[model samples]
Target: MNIKKIMHVENLTHFYGNQIGCKGINFDLYKGEILGIVGESGSGKSTLLKCLSGEISPSAGKINISLDQGGVKDFLSLPEQEKRQLMRSMWGIVHQNPRDGLNLRISAGGNIAERLLNVSEKNYSFLRNTGKYWMEKTEMDSDRIDEFPLSFSGGMQQRLQISKILSSNPQIVFMDEPTGGLDVSVQAKILDTIKSIVRDINVTMIIVTHDLAVVRFLTDKLLVMKDGIVVETGLTDRVLDDPQHSYTQLLTSSILQV
Candidate 1:
């Protein structure tokens, strides 16, 4: 079977003032494939993610993404309103910090319901039941549905964010350091939950993380970036186990040494 390319990014480059964010990046994400972008800090992983997700516009590039309805679109060239609609409808983003993705003032269920609402879901019973279902899927306690996310543990809050993002049934998700800033145990649980959920859904994902273990665990393809460019790209196992690029080798060695 021919793989369907859901997203194609070519010559994607961005700059923070004069500093390069990402330069000459090109990649294609297939339907239901999880792609990982791994690099050290300031290597432009986050910058490239933001550009792809449309949180920030790049200096120049082409981001051709297939919409849920039909046909591919250059999201960067779309009108602001259309872009905003696309983000809410067909795409989801999981931020490194849970606070960046969740509305602290809202109840846990409310947060999930918000995404459903954005997609024009108005039936209260369906929304409520879907919210509970997602909470359960993320390994979160369904009893805490009415509680505020701020009252939940850090790990639980992250799970809530995941539930919210998945509630809308997004075709694609962009995750930046999904397991970052948590203890070893917490990170392991979160990674397991993410891996399990992605396996059960037909969602394509592009995740940016410095964690080699995360790439190995959750991604099918991997890109190793250095100084704003992708230095290596291949099967996750091949690239991680036998990296060809010097930068990729150095990165793997440094992680192993730690």
Candidate 2:
């Protein structure tokens, strides 16, 4: 089956003053595909994700997105309001820290409804029902709809964050270390929920993480970054099994050997 291309990035580059964040990065993401960017600290994987998601502007390059409503459009060239509308309507971003992505003061259901509100969903009963639905999908107890995220565990908070984002039915999601701060058991459950939800919804995603096991489990395609450049890119299994780059070999070996 042939998949439609959703995003095309060409010669994307970003810098922080004199320091390189990412340079000459280019890739294509297709519908319903999960692409992983994996590297150690300071490797620019996160930076690349930010540039792609339009959280930050790149120093140079073009980012074109194929919208379901119409033709391809330049992501960076869009006005701030258009970009904001695009994010609220068609895209979602999940931050590494739950606090960063979530509003701790609001009830879990409120958090989910917030996304709906952003897209101008108004019916109060409908919003409540949708929130309850997503909570159940994320394995969260709907009865706790009124409970604030501040009282939840790290894992639950992350689950709430996922539920909130997915509730919007976004075409593409950008995640930064989705399972970064959690116990192994908790992380496993969260990951399973994420995988199931994405599969059910057929949402495309770009996930940035340092965990090889994470990328191996969640992504079909992989990008390995080092020193602010993509050192290798290939099918996840192929790259892990027979890495073409020395850095990639070291990464896979170091993780598996641990």
TM-score of each model, paired residue for residue: 0.97, 0.98
* Model 1 C-alpha lDDT per residue in residues 1-258, reported as the tens digit of each score: 998888999999998889999999999999999999999999999999989888899999999988767698887998889878877867889999999999999999999999999988999999999999999999988999999988999999999999999989898899999989999999999999999999898789999999998999999999999899999999999998999999999888887654
lDDT of 2 by residue, 1-258 (tens): 888999999999999999999999989999999999999999999889888887899999999999998789999999889888877768989999989989888899899998999988999999999999999999989999999999898898998998899999999999999999899999899999999988898999999999988998899999999999999999999999999999998998897553
Estimate every model's Cα lDDT from 0 to 1. 0.92, 0.92
Candidate 1 clashing pairs, residues 3+ apart or interchain = none
Cα miss at 191, model 2 (Å)?
0.8
The backbone clash count of each candidate, in order, is 0, 0
Candidate 2 colliding pairs: none
